[model samples]
Target: MENSLLVETISCTDGSLVGIATLNRPQALNSLDLEMTRILDKALKDWSQQPEVVAVIFRGAGEKAFCAGGDLHSLYDTMIEYKGQPASANEHANRFFAEEYELDYLIHTYPKPIICWGDGIVMGGGMGLMAGCSHRVVTETSRLAMPEINIGLFPDVGGSWLLSRSPGHTGLFLALTGALIGASDAIYCGFADHALARDQWEPLLQALQSTPWARTAEDFQKVTDLIHALPSIELQTGPLESHRALIDRICQEYDLERIGVSIAALSQNEDKWLSRAGQTYMNGCPGTARLSWELLRRARHMSLADIFRLEFGVAVECAAAGNFQEGIRAVLIDKDRQPKWEPATLEETAGDWMAPYFALSIDDPSHPLATLGR
Candidate 1:
């Protein structure tokens, strides 16, 4: 034990325990690597079975972020080592997505109340974890997004499901642009349940510890009520809220090409935020943009477990393909910020180009996460 996933228990007033999981990779913004994911999975599984454990709280170790995203540096290396192999032949990529998505799915259906201290940066995998929790607390410092477009990957970790259900077409706009949203925006988008000041974390924890738990179905509501009683910081309208009508209009069409054209035209918008979002969409990987759009549509009616299963295949495929590796090289390794995405343009990424990504990477019965929902 490296304590990368620090686990502890706080005794509640009624002698029950509140399990606390702190993601300890602050230097990396508490990014979830394979080891951390495994540790967290085991801890959560054990706690879910423990009679004395009434609830669980998940938080990151630093002031900067809860968890920025997944461990991309490691994924990049895996892609390089397994390059040219079949998607399923890249065992590390397959295992990583399988385990990570399983952990996320566990959180979604956990028996006890789960509170996410989403105080800072929450993106990608972090967003997945937070979305699954029964209660998610955002701070004034919180900034969130699914910036996977920047990395040549579509948002995985159950993001498609969450995005599919967001108000209007805001999710589609976010998927393409990778735009960052703050606390107010997070609550507005239903990604977060409550907002509190960053400094209120200590008070909230102390309140939780002193509470007399009922140890029944009402415990979830009890936790919610306590969080609601806490003081929240005043928030102004976020860019997403301000530009809602425009985003809805732009992404209303079901056709990806029409949506792309509408979003690309925002590059000249007077608001700097909208303009930058448009530029990001214009600069993002064409394949990723297409996947984001299509996945959201498909996930609209799919179960959470099914979405996880679908994302597992897509993630592995991206690793086997060159775009994800190229993205990691440019963004993280080489620091060049110029990924040479295959099929390079939005026009070239349309039609059945993404059909292969949607197919099963691993056979049904033998699939790593085949037992997910069952």
Candidate 2:
């Protein structure tokens, strides 16, 4: 199908079928904007109802990235157009996040087996897309992260749901540090299913198309066997395994204050990875770190729809508070590596300060995402 936001093609081989969706914007690392989100959502919905499409595969056009993130520059420009008035831009941001969240939810509940070939940089919104697929294929070149903290935002796009469920304290560690995970590490953290060499992708695609589509499970197995037929490639070990002891020890503290103390302890540790993670956390937005800690903890028992709703609340509040603009200024616009975060120290960030962000006024059940229901 012809799409302005992406390229879509359906290729058939033998009795099997394949549906390919490629993010077409290589210049922006396939960053998703409102139009892109709409296009993706429409395509996925259509593919779900197509009888000929036995399996779907997602990828990016360039070698550089699967998707770097949402189109924050567009968001920044919109914010500017609204003159930074929170209420003026509130509806626009609300609609965007609602649509994006819906797209993520659709991916999570897709009927057919969806295989995402996350080959390169997959952060923020990209992670949301890939994490929900049935078969998440990563390559040695894959770099996955939920680095929303760097932009003074807590990880959204169902990050609270997925990251909270990661092994041990690994989720919290990644959320706070914005640390990048290679393919093997992604698999270890439950974010990716398999790690195949980048060169093996075409062969795997061919193998997928060669099988009979009538019996999906059997055909899936055939494709798996074909992929396994290739010689096994050595995977770079993840840092998680090596730093497990320290990560568990430091990340065990659920509250932000204790977590800061634990991070301080890591700064003094012998492990280099832990020390680096500590510094990253130290340099990150204290408010966001606290919010991340709270969001994950609270989202544990919440339904997916509820999670999105809660995130919508937080997102609007963040816009109102001016952190989003500052974050965009420092990270994207200024090209400056430094962000002068408010409440610069973790010690200054109190539980009560974050409480207001989480508070949804009972009278205002009018969230743009209020229509979202399980």
Q: For candidate 2, write residues 57-153 as lDDT tens digits.
A: 8898789999998888877766666654654266677777889998988888777888898999999999888978888888878898898878888
Enumerate clash totals for all models, in the order shown: 0, 0
Question: In model 2, where do residues sit more than 4 Å from their true spots?
Answer: 1-4, 83-89, 215-232, 265-272, 361-365
- The model with the greatest TM-score is 1
Q: Which lDDT value does model 2 have at 52?
A: 75
Q: In candidate 1, what are the lDDT values of residues 97-136, reduced to their tens digit?
A: 8899999999999999999999889998899889999999
After TM-score superposition, the amount by which residue 166's alpha carbon in candidate 2 deviates from its true location, in angstroms, is: 0.5
lDDT of each: 0.90, 0.79
Give TM per candidate.
0.98, 0.91
lDDT of 2: 0.79
Question: How far off is residue 240 in model 2, in Å?
Answer: 1.4
